[model samples]
Target: MIRYISLQNCPFDPGEELCKFRSESIGAIASFTGLVRSENEIVALSIEHHPVMTQKTLEQLCDMVITRYHLLGVSITHRYELLKLGEPIVFVAAASVHRKAAMEAIVYMMDRLKTDIPLWKKEIFADGTSRWIEQKQSDVDRSFSW
Candidate 1:
């Protein structure tokens, strides 16, 4: 279930869940969550889906991660629409027999999603100003090094 939740109240990190799921059969779990900061700061973030291509991009990313990691299982979720602060921006959970593979795959998927996925984010300010955060070219370049 490699997916970006897109619009769910996913507060609990999925990593622990994944670990528990695989505990009977595997030894390690890898997970990640992107949170919103405070100071007008957000505790979590919301995601804006690219209606035409976001889901497709996420699927492709999952496939790639699965192949690369040889993971026992995987799960990913992201919120869509006007998500408030402290909400979940994204969640990814993975389980593997080895910690190294799980950790590497987790990092790899995150970098891929941040750069390759077509999802967009609008940073809402306290003053009510909103701006689309541009994808950094350096982010893509960094993914390749992984």
Candidate 2:
């Protein structure tokens, strides 16, 4: 199963869930969590998405990871709109027949989300200053070279 999730109202217990559904057919599972940090001088973050485009981009990302990594299952969750520091921002889980495939799938999904997704974030400072931050090209470039 695959889904785009919101962390605000969802508990991403992918590990526990995977354990319950484990089979001899599946040998590995990898999970990743991204949390909002307080280091950005921001009191809150707002993520914006262009409805249809975001969903299409995310699905294409998932499909690419699945095809590239030979994953049995892949799930990605990203939080949107105003979010406080320390909140869960993203969750990725992948199941595969080997550890390397699961791990690679998670990494690929994250890279795609950061580079291809149409989501943008605005940082709102405690002092009331708001700034829109573009996804840094350098960050995306680094992913491919690695």
Candidate 3:
């Protein structure tokens, strides 16, 4: 099994990361990419995180998902710092022998990451206003489903 998890400040190409998976035993790969939205007149987003804690939490989460889903490989990349509109913010991919497991794993990982990880986001508006986003009840509910 293979696992790659990173919290980076620089931009990454999700396609390049997807191509890195090379396992003869794998039959399906599922992925999700989160991008900064242009809605609400948002100009940019600033993500904040604790380096050590964030990395440790992500590693643990990846390990759990891999074992639970019997995955051949998984990759998760999350970015911090100021990100412009339409920029990619996160990428998650899961590889398994079956399509169901791979697809489910991606959804599970994203749901967990939304609540379990201690990442803070501030939305910057076109009007030069900014606000720290709070966790929505919907996100909390989604994580509880798994």
Candidate 4:
């Protein structure tokens, strides 16, 4: 199985990354993209994480997904920095011989990432103020479904 995970300050193209996951045996690729929404008049979001710890945590998550779903390949890319409204924040793709496993892996990994990932985020409002974003109960509930 092929796996790639990266947390970088720069932006990434999900389509381009998915191209690398295509293989003869992999017939299905399930993907998800998380974007910064323009809610509450927020102008941007600033995300931070402990470099070493964040990478290790992400790798462990990918490993678990790959094992549970028997995926042929997976890629996860999350960005850190000040990102504007409508900007892409995270991209995940899982490939397998069939669609079911690929789809489930994508959802499982995203749900866990939303709650378990060690990342700090703050929303910058247009009024020149910001607040640290907290994990919501809804997100916890979603993870519980797994």
> For candidate 2, lDDT tens digit of each residue in 19-123?
543556778888888777886788888788887888777788778788888777777777777777877777788888899999978877787777788888888
Clashes of 2: 0
Model 3 spans with C-alpha error above 4 angstroms: none
Query: How does model 4 score by TM-score?
Result: 0.96
Give candidate 2's error at residue 126 in angstroms.
0.6
Clashing pairs in 2: none
lDDT of 2: 0.74
lDDT of 4 by residue, 16-130 (tens): 8888885799999999999999887899999999888889999999999999999999999999988988878999999999999999999999999988889889999888999
Instruction: Quote each prediction's TM-score.
Output: 0.79, 0.83, 0.97, 0.96
Show where candidate 2 strays beyond 4 Å: 1-24, 143-146
RMSD of 2: 2.8
Sorted by lDDT (best first), the order is 3, 4, 2, 1
The segments of candidate 1 whose C-alpha lies over 4 angstroms from its true place after superposition are 1-23, 39-46
lDDT per residue, candidate 1, 69-110, as tens digits? 887767777766666566556778777788998898888888
